[model samples]
Target chain A: MKHTHAEENYLKAIYMLSEKQESLVSTTAMADFLHTSAASITDMIQKLHNKGLVIYRKYQGVTLTDRGKESAIKILRKYLLWEVFLVDKLKFGWSEIHEIAEQLEHIDCDTLIDRLDHFLGNPYCSPHGIVIPNADGKIIDKPRWLLTDLSEGASGIVSAIKDDSVAFLQYLGKRNIYLGAKITVIEKIQFDGSTDITIDNQYKINISRKITDNILITL
Target chain B: MKHTHAEENYLKAIYMLSEKQESLVSTTAMADFLHTSAASITDMIQKLHNKGLVIYRKYQGVTLTDRGKESAIKILRKYLLWEVFLVDKLKFGWSEIHEIAEQLEHIDCDTLIDRLDHFLGNPYCSPHGIVIPNADGKIIDKPRWLLTDLSEGASGIVSAIKDDSVAFLQYLGKRNIYLGAKITVIEKIQFDGSTDITIDNQYKINISRKITDNILITL
Candidate 1:
């Protein structure tokens, strides 16, 4: 079924929130994410339910139907693809591409997005390190090991990170451990879960447990 | 001053048309370009005149002011840059990016476009070979020579082409002489205004003088 940009956004939000929480997406949460009133969310949800895009029940929240999920995934693919183009090709900062991608995700052309995917050389991940799903919603597999999972003396290349927060990315920038950096685990602190790693035969840096958990490495 | 997407489009159309034809842009021409009614065009043009974005005189057509022209140029830059991203990074066909870029040009955010400019490495021309004006309206200098200006046996690269018609672009595609392809002039037949050119040392093709004139070359 044809959907408006506003409807697609609502569906995508519900799909994302549901995935994170593993439960039905609440109207309140949808309203919060969309910056609209709960009543508005309820109205929109009802419309989506009528269209069979969602399975909705009052006070029980909502979960998208297969068609709705497919639509949401398609939007996500376009969004992440555009994000990769913005960062990898255009050199846009990761923090900046989100809002623009938000606006771009609503562009309703499949061929354009497909061609864009080719233009970007079919990037596996966006600038913020999020995996971009393919046209059929198949996720690209990349070699990734968690920083905290590495034992002392284990070595690998930094492939990508999971967290996309601006502050965390900036901290990574300061540490000089960007994507494609080679590093070895020097030590692992038992108490706080921090790790000491050497980068490029030069600087030895201590990474907090929280930060280490977010970093991904190629085995 | 802020302008709506509709207003910006009108200004851009007027600016582009004025560059080729008379300074006065007619309602019928604008209506044809925008696919809107002549009455709607009249209403919007008057509104733009009131906002001082255009100079409008009854029965004399419309002309954009300097401010309007600047805004129009900015929109053009965004549109064309997005086209580059769509084609170069996303792998979209030249014909496909135009409609998507049309939608993208309406996204109102300077930070987004500026960052996008940086992300796309400040491209001077789009995939369809249109020059993208810089932030300050400075056109990027490229080594361009018209196909009509080439002497017999002169060698050059295809930098851009003037025409965007689907048939012409398709013809170029069929001949494998897209932007950035190297070409060497083989022979020029003055009688018929036709020229034979060698492409990438593989094939020599004969092209009419009209086609040659429309194609731009880089020395």
Candidate 2:
């Protein structure tokens, strides 16, 4: 089925909001996430609902139908696979790939995606440490924890990035922090939530609260 | 300045039609090339002209402005690099990469395209034998000849495929013909344009005029 780029983006937003638990997502929440107006979100949601992609209820929210979920996963699968290709194959830094992958996700060729999936050796997860759902949208059930949750002296491998922004990723890259980089927290400042950590037992770096909150880790 | 995908397509069409001799392209010819109406072509050509991408005259057709030509080359460069990645890295047949590349060309990132070019070892020609313009929109000049032009017992390497259709490419692939493959014409059937040829010093195949006209060779 063909969809306008806007419609597809809405489906992806609703899917992500409801990923952890299949719940109805408020239009207001989606509006905030997309940085669009609530009225526009409501309008788009109703359009998606009419297309059998979502179930929208007045004063309630919206939930993806089975068809909608499949579409979202397909879009996400392409995005994640491209991220892997950009980072692993093209040698693009993890932070630099998200925007590029965002553009690549809409290429609309199942054969190309399948070929890339095979070429990448069928990875179980995206470079960001997030689950990359299979053809059936089934994924491994490992939950990721934010780096901000760690206490002083806590150590773990960087599992994923909560903020995949080029600026943030570039900063992390400059500090030698990336997926699978081992880190031990030296201190966590309560005043502003800033974090002082030793990365790979080598460089000691202090990051702002915004940065710490965005780096996910697995203990 | 961002142009819609439609506008970009018009620029590419104008550039391609003008490729051989930098001549003005007629609206009827462009309409024929794009499978659109003359009226629609005039409308788009006007829009592109207003945007400074091309210069159009009433009864005459259009010519790409410097800006328009640059944009077209950029799009073409992305498309060609992806063809290389698909054929060389992902092992897709040369015939299958064009459609996928058509979608990939609009990715809107110079860095991504440049990185891909570097990753693909900076090739000068696409899998189909067209030049891949550099970031600066520069390409080496190499005139290509048609396979149909080859006489009996004449030989050269397969340099490009004029027919980018998957069916034609798949046919060529099945016959073990590809870019850089050596070929010698056994005979050219005069009644029909079909040619019998030996490929790569091994495989012998008889290809219809439809296929031969579309395949290019360089001696």
Interface RMSD of each: 2.3, 0.8
Stretches > 4 Å off in candidate 1: A58-60, A119-121, A127-129, A139-144, A151-159, A162-214, B57-60, B115-124, B127-129, B139-144, B147-158, B162-215
Stretches > 4 Å off in candidate 2: A20-22, A142-219, B142-219
Q: What is candidate 1's CAPRI-style docking category based on DockQ?
A: acceptable
- Evaluate candidate 2 and give its CAPRI docking class based on DockQ: medium
Steric clash pairs (candidate 2): none
